[model samples]
Target: MDSIDLEVLKTAAAWLNAGHRCELVTVIKTWGSSPRPPGAMLAIREGGEIVGSVSGGCIEDDLIASVARDGVSQTAPFLLDYGISADQARRFGLPCGGTIQLAIEPLSGASGLPELLARLGRGETVERRIDLKTGAVTLRGASADSTLHVDGDTLATVHGPRWRLFIIGAGQLSRFLAQVASAMDYRVTVCDPREEYRMGWDLPGVELVHCMPDDLVLEAQLDARSAVVALTHDPKLDDLALMEALKSDAFYVGAIGSRANNAKRRERLKLFDVTEAQLARLHGPVGIYIGSKTPAEIAISILAELTAVKNAVPAELLVPHATAAPMSVAGCVIP
Candidate 1:
């Protein structure tokens, strides 16, 4: 599955390749409560067909109508602001006092979108800079921490998978997690040394390796933008991976197990000289308490918690509505 930004870039490239004029609109800045954050994009064909969104439907409608009537006449990029006034905010369905500034760039050969797509295809994070005075663009290697920046004369946006997920098992639940994480634009790798499990893995765009999980964790050199999840129930596999991951800078390190199992895992890690602070970083009983029973639902719940951590949301806000213990069969959760 393609991310929304990827879809926009691909659609814009397709339109340009088919001899159609299109404009790329990206949110550069926002004030107050806006519907979309900075870096949200929209691709508008000359005929007003659009592939992405920058705001609620009302703002899109206006852009489409303007492009359909005017035929993308601009030769250079320009700034367009919306919802600057109370009446305009009402008209655009923006929150009161909300304002969004967009960089509307006319697509052309100078935009370098095809090259951007190619670099992203190679699994490299990229920083794309566009000159506002002209449509010329430059693409260069970027770190995972790169972000969107807009100066007076240039608009820079980070593209590609800036985050990565390292899964320590290639089982059924791992398959679901890999698929969902890929759609969320995470570069995912599932490591399993067992041949029986490795041979059956067939997901596209996800890397599968036949190696020990702990070795892969060390080789990855996980950063703050990375995550580690141990889905295998084996103590040998999950325990070693957890030990290395907990000591790394990975923002979220989790393992799948019941509450009692989680406690046991912590105790075992303690014996390995893992510090209390480092062990505290582990998120066992992995996901938020969503009462999920199936593998797919469990994947959603796990990603929900990961998203919460990524966004710096307080854990107190995610307390389950019911305080009852989760249901399990024979000391194993259904997930």
Candidate 2:
């Protein structure tokens, strides 16, 4: 599923290219239990067709009503506010004290949206800056660390997939993981030196490569936004990669195996001069342990764990806490 914000941009671009008028609405500010965060976008066409969301359904409903009544004009972008008072909040279906500030602007050639989409397609992280008074837009290459910034009548939002996943296998499990991760806006690359296993691999938004896992890991320059998951289960392939990945700054490093195999893998890594701290960073028997028994289910569990880590969830709240009963994903019965 395309995230609502990205889908909004793509739909607006399509409408613009098709010679239809469309307006882009972004949530630039919020307070007191807002329905969406800053930088959330919604696109509305001249004909009242809409995509994406800035609030719960009620907010979108109000936006559509505005378009239908006022029509999306070619004037400069302006800010709008909702739920400013108790009566207004009740009418807009917002929480008692919630408020949302929006930046709504018409899309056109000067918006640089097509170019922005092109850069995103090339896997480049981009920053789109909009001048609130002039309705002008500019696109620039951004560092992986850049985030959305709104200040002083200007809005700068990051676009494109900012996260990367390096999967050290092209097996069935890797396919599901890759597909789901891609949907979550991760640029995934699958590496496997085994030609037999690499055959018939076909998935969009994922790169397939015939390379040793260790070499790929070293070359990846895995930063905090990156992740490494080894699903090959082959010691020669997975161990070297894990050793490199765990020592790097990647936010998550994991390998799939049973509890016994994971324990053995840790013991074996110690001979390679892998330090205690680095070894502790390894997530073995990888996933949140939600009783996954199939490849698809396993993919879900891994994503859940990865998400928890990404969101900085506390240890006590993370699924299958370190002190809880251990479960193996290697065909173990839940009982």
Tell me, by TM-score, which candidate is best: 1
- Candidate 1 vs. true structure, TM-score: 0.94
Task: Put down candidate 2 lDDT per residue, 1-335, tens digits, no spaces.
Answer: 45566678889999998999999988878888888888788899987999988888888998899889998878998889998998888888788688988888888978998888778778788999999899888889998778887789888888878889999999999999998898777889999999999999988668999989999999998899999999998999999999999889999999888767788999999999999999988877788868777899999889988888888998677654232375545575322
Summarize candidate 1's per-residue lDDT along 195-283 as a digit string, tens digits. 98888678878999988999999999989999999988899999999999999999999988877778889999999899999998888
Q: Each prediction's TM-score against the native?
A: 0.94, 0.92
The residue pairs found clashing in candidate 1 are none
List pairs with backbone clashes in candidate 2: none
In candidate 1, which residue ranges exceed 4 Å CA deviation? 320-324, 328-335
